[model samples]
Target: MINNKKYLVSFMLLVASVFTSNGQDDMDKFVSNLLQKMTLEEKLGQINLSSGNTGAVLGGGGEGQLIAIKKGEIGATGGSSFESIKKIQDAAMESRLKIPVLIGLDVIHGYKTIFPIPLALSCSWDTDLIERSAQIAAKEASASGVCWTYSPMVDIARDPRWGRVSEGSGEDPWWGSQVAKAMVRGYQGGDLSKNNTIMACVKHFALYGASEAGRDYNTVDMSHLSMFNGYMEPYKAAFDEGAGSAMSSFNLVDGIPATGNKWLMTDVLRDRWGFDGFVVTDYTSINEMAYHGLGDLKTVSALALKAGIDMDMQGLGFIGTLKESLDDGLVSMEQIDQACRRVLEAKFKLGLFEDPYRYLDENRLKNEVLTDENLEAARELAARSMVLLKNENNILPLNKKGKIAVVGPLAEATGDLLGAWVMYRNRDIVPSIVEGIKSVGGDDVEVLSAIGANLTNEPNLRKSLSSPFAMFMGEKMVVDERSLEVLIDEAIAVSADADVIVAVLGESTAMSGEASSRADISIPESQRNLLKVLLKTGKPVVLVLLNGRPLTIEWESENVPAILEAWAPGTAGGNAIADVLFGGYNPSGKLTMTFPRSVGQIPIYYNHQNTGRPFDENNKFTSKYLDISNEPVYPFGYGLSYTSFEYSDVEINKSKLNGNDKLIAKVTLTNTGDRAGEEVVQLYISDPVASISRPVKELKNYKKIMLQPGEKKEIVFEITPDDLKFYNSELIYDWEPGEFSIQIGTNSQDVKTASFVWEK
Candidate 1:
């Protein structure tokens, strides 16, 4: 009977493989036929991506964009409204070939129904939830007539100083790789041809996250071994999961702009990793190559074409100069056709040839965008994204009956809750923290609210930052001309009668994202002054932080009774915060990035390589800091729950692991506290000896499990030689024979460890 079942399963698998092969064959035939009949100018048009004059307009020559579309001089356009996108598609239909333009947008965290920022979402440690969030975003975006998303920015970021870190997964390459796969699956779904699914673009192709000094668009110089071992995993994972497109980073790889780096875009992405996706340059990246001293516009355009970049996004380099380069023999007709074919192939896979209006259902747009179901999902995700940084004496789960004063500038503001790279049109739907407290308190708790200070006291800085995104629908940072004493007096008056205070503070919407890096990532002085006074009110304070990146909150950690890393919780952020505060949900989110005690520890992270002289707190001659301790204020994967858990020391099945042999490591976990809650059981492996220096600890696997109060469960993880593998000095991916430590615990720093030996 077992043999018959196996035979039947094998038969089914064979049939599925044949089906997939037939589909690929069909796609190849269609793309081949389409490429043959295309003119040189028309083919150049296929590789040109222009931004429509509507949302976040960046490039010039917008006046002729419509005419360009009608003449088949444009293939794709991004950052435009649905109405405008349809007009471009209509113009494209007027061309001789009637090719539909692929619509792209920065649907990063969400579309209309925004969720927590990507950094916050990573803290959930739940790939399923992350995938669901992406699926919802794709549904909303597709309904709104967008066929592609420049999202799943899977760049692995370790430094909090990098503003774009908010858009990626956390520090560890393994964790980032998981997020990359989940996001790709979510955006594309089971099939790309479906109306609700949009093509996923894995971005910043070659290490934008590792920018020098954590500055965006800075140069990155690293060994090939370092690249393969640490930084390149997420992009490769995204490609493995079938991401349809890739975006070149703004930084240089090996001293050459990635937009013109042939070895990176072609050799690594295509030849090495087998990524069959089309590549697009970041906004005018091709044009910026001139500034990089690579060449003139035409020279850079030709270089970019040969670098395996299929489309020039907003650069106009391909459209403006590729023809001239082609005549000059700098670019060949075959190269242009190859680039054009890839773009057309992507459009063909999206089923745009059959139905250009697949994602243009007016009914879906009305019924689907920001629906209650989507909003509820966002709320649930936001709640899960919240990391309980500190909960001294269980100050949270505040009794719903008390007088709760919601203070701080962010308390009543809805616009700033949605982080950077968000759908700008969804500001009105966001509920303020005050509204959330009231809605959830429901007459049980008297929720007093006050804006204690402006988001920033610097009026000129706020205005300068606000002007860029003023075109989008949302509230900007409003500088109060009133005296600081007046704002504080008003806040103190409101909180004077309150039993407890919930202080909502942190970066405004303009703070940590894409060109908004800060040397000191801390609570602003204006808000800190308010917080210092609030503590004097003799009330238990809960610091609810809303920022894009991990902040240095050493003072708050030591003084505040409770603190929550809310991140920019998005449209449903307020209600989510209320739910967690009132014990409706227990926070299971963990920090994906390390929180340092001071700005001096700028590039701190969990999986860092130990120096020749490791930090010794007692030894001044060691690698310890002069003022602050070497440890992070809060380590990666650290979080608190309403309940407490105790873990037993790791038990290994065997002390030795051989090639292809799986070793079992078990840990007995018990819910020792009063309330039932969930915990993320993380697994880390330490390679004390390797071909080259390795990180002290590296995350290999993790599982999020729920347990009833006083209940005990045994968790087991399978370890193999593959998990211990890393790129050696020679850039070879292999594992060396060594003694390794296996750790099982709640976070990276605190773990129960056991040693084992791996033999070749």
Candidate 2:
């Protein structure tokens, strides 16, 4: 048995070595051969990424652009449709070198058949499902003629005030890295040459999520140790999983714009991490460097190229000013060639060089996109993405036998269901909350809905919310202009005739993505008024929140008997919510981000460092808030299932460990409630003493499992010294020989623990 195990290990090692050696050799050979034959003009064109109108909120390119493509003046485009991409590729075929154009898009969550937003999807704690969503997105997108997707934004976001928090996996670097790897594998598949797969691009290169005050495109300043410890894990994870491309962020990394930051782009990414993928700038980011006080377009463009940016997305800086910069001795020919080679290498790896029309199948487009099978998957995923925040007295798993009154501006909202970065027409096809309730509840349950209030009561505020970028934000919710009292009265009237009320309330889709940060992360005043009136009617109220970021819902949590965070669940959102509400599906999703009681706890997260003086209600000198406690409304990994789970004390296989040693931590979990359900078993490690102060507890591993009522299951996790390593004060990545705590829990705060020692 020992000999057989050794043989199996040897075989796997040999296979991995061969895969790496051959893949790199083939890619380098193809790119080199292509580069040798290319002219200066063609080389520059390969580093140019312009945009085309796919009816989304980016640039538009037409026949004039097609002529440029034929001249080998364009390399890639975003937001272009299949028909348009075919035209662009056809134009490229007429070029001297016939290099195919790569079609890309911000296929964030889902392509046509939209799923839950990224933030909500992470709540499932199901990497397999997240990967499946990415795989389906790739299939749908590739069918539509796109070969690349700008997604899996794995930024570790702690501040909910950042609107783009909706686009990421939440605040824990360890968990976020896992999600990142899953997304990359899902998009690129095992082989990039597959006709159904698309290339994955890890985005916003550095700490764009930690923008000051949670504002988009703001300055980011953090220590090197902090960067390595916290923000850099997801990008590294994606690269390790073989993502083909990266996008430079809009923010400055230590005072220099990321587009022109050499230490970041070259030293950290290329040299240290050994990333061979091409780097592209976010929309006009290279050009925006001028506004960042870097220099003129030409100077900043030259800096970006020198800093290792391979392509300029929506910024014609490379094509327009690179040659001039070259002649001026501001950039070298070798640097230009290197950038161009990387871009061409991506095309080669995508199999576009061999067959330009590989992804342009009309039959696949017809059969694959928005199919019933895909929508069903979307519905199932959306159902899993929902986190049940509060279920007082078992108020949820609601019976479908009663009349359900759905009230709020978002209750009947169709467009908002398909969150940001989606086609405008998707809203027309999605089922509204009321429609979903009706569909799932069937003939027995009567579902009635009313737009209880406008998204906001103030007229001027509604106007301010309007966005010129219509495709990205969608048209602002139209105000009723009727008196607030009248809207509340109608809501009350609807609830009076129903056995139960579902108050669908929260931000509109536009209010929680990109540049849409909110200072007050709560139910809007108008919706709060509507909810209060509904509560007064003596009906059992269920607060169904359809939002992007984590909201401060203290009032709702206290007053409402049940609260469900639906989180802009996509095309089949209504149906998914219906399934959960009507007891067809049990809620298993956990909170990836912390839910604060108030916005004052802006940057609160579970893996926070301990203060010199820890919080103490008894001591006035400690880090305690006089007005409120330091606890969050709902801690990270917190969620409620229809059935409850009980955890046993953590048992460790070893009390001491040395080099290459494995420690097994085990715990017994039992479903103590009446029904069968799923739970996320989380394992966290704590370094009580280290060179630098570490977080109170860092999540190391997690598992999602199902159990029948009264059934017990044993959960085991293998731990190693490598898991104890962190970036220290000197920025050294290594573990210290010390005592550590192994915590096993359903959530971060509630845990059972055991201790062990490690010697170097």
Candidate 3:
């Protein structure tokens, strides 16, 4: 058996060597040869990323695109289907050099069999699950001829008001970095030459989540220390995981647009971080730079090329004006060659040079897309992504034999279950909440449903909230024409005979994605009124929220018997929710972002620097809110389980340590309840004194473990001086030797602490 295993490994190595002979040296020589034969027009075309005529939001180019492909005037195209992409590849085969075009797509969460949004997935704290989901998405996408995906958005979002928060991993930079690395590994795998893998594009290159006023595409400004410590870790982590591509954000960095910022793209990303991948602009960002107070198309295109941008997506600036800029001495050929070479290098790595049609297999598309196995995996992930915010008196893991009443605007919602950035999903196949309850409840269980209210009271607001891409995707927000009074009356009548009411209420799919930021992050008036009336009926209510971001649910937190944060669980969402509700599965998810008590606390987060005068109840001059407490409604790393768990005091192996010593911390965790449950044991570090101010505590490590009732286990973590290091005021990364606090807990707010000292 050992000899056979060794032979298998040798065979695999031989296959890889055969495919990539001399590796990087071979890739360099091949691209260099191609660059010599290409004219100036062809070189510019190598950096031109056109859009397909697939009715996508950023789609363009119909017959003209085919002509350009034949003339070797296009390097890549996004948003194209299998048939269209095959047609585009055929056109490329007719070009002078017969260079095939790279196919790209959004494929954010999933391609066909969708999973929960990235924010919700992060709550699971299961890197293995997240990685498997990405692998499935890559399989489905590669089968459909997509070799590149602009995904794994690693922006660390602190403000829940930022609509794009749904697309990121959440507020903590350390945890978000873990998610970023997992996603990159999942998408790219160990071998890019395989047809099943797709190149991962870690995006919005710089700090895009810190937009002013939590508005999308707004200007971002902050100190260098804050930038390095708070927002930049995840992006760097993704790149370090061997991500092959990146997308420039649609915001300004250092007073210049990211598409043309030399310091950002060239100095920081390329020189400092040593990112060797190609960089692409986000949806005509170069053209939009003109609106950002930069020069016209010609000037911005030249600037972007010199700033290390390799590809222009949906922007004709490069192919249309680079030659003019070259002739006018505005840009040099060397810079253009560098960009073109990187693009070609990516193609060679994808094995496109060996076989352009490697990923366009019809059989794989027929058997792999939306398979039963993939859907089952999606269902399990969606269940794990659900965070049980509150479960007073153990109201969840509901019995399947009771009469279940499902009510709300989203009770029977089909399309909304898939959430945002799902371009290739089959909404008709998605089972609604009512359907799921009925199917999972069985013959003895009785199920009832009603539309309690409209998504919003105003027709104009509903229409305005619809996604712009809905027109092309055959999607529209369905608003009932009946009056709110009539809807509530019907809802009340339906729930009167039920044993329990499950209110599936929250924002529609259009309410929380790009450009959908809201000033009031609370339940809508229409839905809130319905919920109040239902509560008056004296029936037990379980609030199942479907929002993308953390909402201000202070009222519901106080009134609702139980609450579940089910953030737009994807295609199998309903089935997954039912699985958790009926005790088929145990929910073990935790909140990745902090839930503020009110919208006024826009920037509330767990790891925040202390103010000169910290908040105090007795000190009138201290930093405090007069109307409310300074604490959040639900703190970060917070969540509930069906069974309870207790933590013992933290134990340290030593109270003092030297420069190279390792401090060992241990905690005894016991399941104190009557059922089995999973718990996320989090570890945090705090420095009492530093060269500059530091956050109160920063998450350093974590472990998710499952414990049966009455089980007791010791959790241990080894800390080195490296874990205590941070970027200082002078931008130097190091640690200050001093007294430090080590904390271990179920969540950030509730923890047992121990102190240790380290000397340099």
Expressed as tens digits, the lDDT of each residue in 427-545 for candidate 3 is: 88899988888888888789888999988876565776664654333246677888877999999999999888999999888888787788888999899999998889898889999
For each candidate, what is the lDDT?
0.86, 0.87, 0.88
Root-mean-square deviation of candidate 3? 4.8
Candidate 1 root-mean-square deviation in Å:
6.5
Query: Would you list the rank order by lDDT, best first?
Result: 3, 2, 1
Off by over 4 Å in 3: 1-22, 52-61, 466-475
- Identify the runs in model 1 with alpha carbons over 4 angstroms from their true place: 1-22, 51-63, 470-475
Cα RMSD (angstroms) for every candidate in the order listed: 6.5, 6.8, 4.8
Q: Please give, for residues 1-760, the per-residue lDDT of candidate 1 as tens digits.
A: 0022433343344233322332778667767766776788888888888753233343222546777777887898874566776667666666767777888989999998998989889999999999999999999889867899999898877788888889988888999999999999999998999999999999998888889888878888887877888899999999999999999999889999999999999988988889898999999999999998998988999999998889998878898898899889998888898898899889878977656777777788888888999999999999999999899988988897979999999998788888887755566778899999999988888988888888776555567457756335234667667888889999999999999999999987778788777776888888998999999999889999999898889998999999988999999999999999998999899999899898788778888888998877777778987788888899999999999999998999999877777889999999998888999999999999877889999999999999999999999999988898888887778889879998999999999999988888
C-alpha TM-score for every candidate? 0.95, 0.95, 0.96
Residue 238, candidate 1: Cα error in Å is 0.5
Could you tell me which 10 consecutive residues in candidate 2 have the lowest summed lDDT? 1-10
- Prediction 3 TM-score vs. true: 0.96
| Clashes per candidate, residues 3 or more apart or on different chains | 0, 0, 0
